[model samples]
Target: MLLNCDLGESFGAWKMGLDEQVMPHIDLANVACGFHAGDPDVLAHTLSLVKQHQVTLGAHPSYPDKQGFGRRSMQMSEQSLTNTLHYQIAALEGMANVQQLSVSYVKPHGALYNDMMNNPQLLKWVLQAVARYSRSLKVMILATAEQDKHRELAHKIGIDLMFEAFADRLYTDEGLLTPRSQPNSVHNKQALLQQVSQFHDDNSVTTNTGKRLPLVADTLCVHGDNEASIMLIQDIKQLLNT
Candidate 1:
């Protein structure tokens, strides 16, 4: 399993994740674009760290909601949403190009990511945006235990989709991630290790309801905002390697 983290989320004076320490431990870095919490300087610095660590770079795009931190959902037309996605991704890709690095994957941030998974129309537009950027750029989405509508749409769109499982997020009874607003949405260290161990054993995640939800995924994500997650990321790496 490939370990990944959201990076470059820090805005001007406000620093977010510990990209310096976290980049060295993960296989993929989902660098945030300017829309959510990243500025030009932050993106450049983050890219440098990613390049130094030789980690794979991915575009982390979100709605044009910086104040909300891209966590709140918005009502948007399909064309507008498509344009927003393309623009944010292109911004990151453009920066990466100048630095002699290329973005290999695309992952939507917060609400946009959640919207795409549940709304087929929105997912199509997002996929369309991805195809517009690069046919080969793989889009990352949450992996479900059972049926994944997003996967089917991505296959039809002809762009590769990479399924992702979270180490810190809580899962619902239906194998979907519980809404972050709910209590216990974030996992404790013990629960996290248990989930990772299960995935490391086979590609399955134990849901909150105590069911072994089968999750076939390509990458594992740990939010970089948590300072304690650095240790969790290391522990997960150790578990996976062992």
Candidate 2:
């Protein structure tokens, strides 16, 4: 029942969410490395805030496309993709070491994440990189009954896996997240709160298609880019605690 947010997304002159405001309510902070939307200074600052708030730190690695903010997939060879992932993880690990903190997990960002779930070859590469670089760190995969193969592969490889459900996103009947292009991919606070209540009560999620799907997950994701996300997170935490 941990709540996780993507932080340290501000790169260079561009600023992102209010990490400090959101950190207090969250249990985990997925800090972005340079591959997607962060810099070394941002990483250092974010790590300090996470340490102060006692939130578990996770690495948010993405494809090396910063322009699209790693939301767009790149057509790279398997070796190239693996190499980039290793590089990003290592960079974050080094930053964490500087602050005497260790990364607790890894969650691929944006397109890389979606691709890994649907493409076995890419998934294998990501899993291999995690094993080779940060073997002890858990990989957070999107929760879905249809993607059990990815979970099985992780277990077979001896890598710890964590299933994550999106608190602000809609799901399909098959238990996959609704595509961002869809009209109601993201939810408002009221809808999100209602969904959270249902999930807390029964571990079930109602998809956009009006089908109920049983879901069991260790963590829930709240996107940093959403404007009202911090308020939503605070409310959800209160609801869960009560």
Candidate 3:
């Protein structure tokens, strides 16, 4: 399976993630647009890294919430949501164009992603935005129990879908990610590697309640917000390679 990470989250002097260090280890870089964390320079530098590492780029868009880090849900009218998505995707595509690179997909960030998964109308808007932007760009989403349902919707919207499983996040018995607000929502180093192994070896993951849930995923996602997570990312890469 291909590995992906949320990179380019660092904003101005307030840095976040070791993007320069972790870029080489990932297959896809979900580089954040300004709304969540990244600034113009950060986006440009990240695109350069993607080119340097020969990694695919994907636009990581979110609600216009730098304060909550795009983790807090926000309500928006359909037109406004559409405009918001288009604005973010266009920003990344424009910068990528300068480097002779292109974004292959769009992954809604944090609350926008979780909200889209749980709300059909919101997802339709998201798909429509991506479809309008460029049908060539796929929408990356969580791999859950309702794969067929998601696929059917995306098909109707005339956009492709890429389902990704989190390597460092806890899963529920239903195959959805454990809410981050919960205790132990994220895995430790050993647990993270074990989860990646399970995804590689079994096409499944052990949920928070210790139940094995089958997952058909197109890609695996790992975090790299700190030095420790960066080491865990290297271990995950090695584990997946094995």
Candidate 4:
């Protein structure tokens, strides 16, 4: 039932969500590296805040596309993808070292994450990069009911895996997240709370189409960009505590 949020996304000229206010309620903070959104100063500030709040720190790396905020997919060769991930992870590790904090996990951001779910080659490359850097750092991934080959590969490579579920997103009957392009992809605060409560109660969730789906996750993700996201996160924390 650990709650995590994507934060530290503010780039040089552009600003993002309120990390200071949100940090107090989140148990884990996924700080974005420079690839998607964030700079050295922002990462340093985020690390300090996470340390102050005693929240676990995770590295959020994405394809090198700051223009689209890493949401858009980019065609990258295997070598390029591996090198990019290594660079992003290294940058965050450096910042964490300077703050006397360690990165506890790695969560691929935006398109890169979705790509890894279906692309075995990409998943292997990403896992290799993570293992090469540090096998102790856990890789957070969306939970799927069927046996996940990538998850098995991660474990075989000596990297810890943290299965994650989204609190504010809808899922299909096939154990995959509803596509964002669809109308039912996102959920309101009350709906999200209800789903989370059901998950806590029965370890299952009802999809938008009223299909009961079993889900087991070690961590839940709450996106920071949504306007109502902060309220939803607060409600989730309150409910989980109760």
Candidate 5:
């Protein structure tokens, strides 16, 4: 499976993630928009690094919650949410255009991503924004028990969909991501490897409840913000290679 990671989170003065060390290992780069943790300079630098490594570029739009690092969900009107999504993608497009690069896919970040999976109304708004921006933008979505629900909706909207499986997070028996605030939200190296190992053999994940949940993965995600992310990615590459 192709590997992906969130990058471009380092804002001015404050720093986060092992982007430089991890970029070479990832196949997709989800660059953060300014509303979250990236500035124009950081975005430019991140896009450049990902391009240098020949990784596919993807835009990561989030709820306008930089202070909460986009992890906090917001209740917004349909119009406002649609506009916010369009705004973030356009911002990344503007920077990418300058570098002779173009984003090929879209992935919501933090609460926005979680909301898309849980709230169908919010997902429709997000998809509307993506289609309005460009029908060609493929959308990245989490692969869960409700995978067919997304496929049906995305098919109806005529937007291409890519399913992603998490490499470092715990899953619930229902195939939903366990809340990050809960314990064992992020897996240790051995746990992470054990989870991904199933992806190759059966396209499945071992849930926190010890159930095997089937999933289809177009790409595998590793969180760059974790202290163990670099090492985790290294093992992921090694495992995939084997």
Candidate 6:
């Protein structure tokens, strides 16, 4: 499976993920588009890095909540959300054009992601925004048992979907990711690798209740927020390679 990470999240004096270290290891980068955490310089640098590593580029748009890092959901009308998405995606597309790098997909970051998956109207709004922006660009979203339903919706909207599974987060029995606020929602390094291993070996993940859930996905999502996470990503890369 292709490995993807959320990158280009640093803003001004504050830095986020170790993009320099992680860029080489990942195959696809969901770059922040100045809404949640990235600035114009960050997007340019990240596009350069992705080009350097020959990695695919994706726009990681979020609600305009940098303080919460886009983890807090906000109430937004369909028109407003679509307008915001167009603004962010177009901004990144414009910047990437200068580097001759094309953003191949759209991946909503943080709460926008979670919220869209649970709300059908919101998901349609996101798909419509992407369709309006570019029919060639696919929408990356969580992989679940009901993915066929989502695929149908996207097909009706004249766009495609790329389902992704998380490598370091726990899953629920309902095929959703466990909420981050819950205890043990995030896995340790050993457990994280084991989860990825299970995904690679069986096309399944053991849920929090110890039930195996089938998760067919095109790509796997991994993090590079720290030294340990970077090591985990490298190990995951090696594992997938083998």
| Residue-level lDDT tens digits of model 3 in 98-157 | 999998999999999999888889988999888988547999999987888989999998
| Candidate 3 vs. true structure, TM-score | 0.96
- The alpha-carbon lDDT assigned to residue 175 of candidate 6 equals 79
* Model 1 alpha-carbon drift over 4 Å, by segment: 146-148
lDDT of each: 0.86, 0.86, 0.90, 0.84, 0.88, 0.92
lDDT tens digits, residues 1-242, model 2?
88998999998788999888888888989989898799978889999999899899999999998899999988988788878988888899898988899988999999999998777788888887888774588888888865567677888888988888888789888677888888989888888888888778888899987989988888888755554767777788888777
Number of clashes recorded per candidate: 0, 0, 0, 0, 0, 0
Indicate which candidate wins on TM-score. Answer: 6
Per-residue lDDT of model 6, residues 71-165, tens digit only: 99999998899999999999999999999989899999999999998888899999998999854799999999788899999999899899999
Better of 1 and 4 by lDDT: 1
Error of 2 at 163 (Å): 0.5
Runs of candidate 3 with Cα error greater than 4 angstroms are none
Looking at model 1, residue 232 earns an lDDT score of 77
Lowest summed lDDT over 10 consecutive residues: which window, candidate 2?
222-231
Q: lDDT per residue, candidate 5, 1-242, as tens digits?
A: 99988899999989988888889889999999888889988999998897799889999999999999999999999888888888998899889988888999999999899987888888888887787785489999889898898889888888888999988789998688898889999887788898888887789988887898889889998877665777778888888888
**Per-residue accuracy of model 1 over 202-240 as CA lDDT, tens digit each:** 778777778877888888987665667788788899998
Scanning candidate 6 in windows of ten residues, the lowest lDDT window is 128-137
- The 10-residue segment with the lowest total lDDT in model 4: 143-152
Best-performing candidate as measured by lDDT: 6
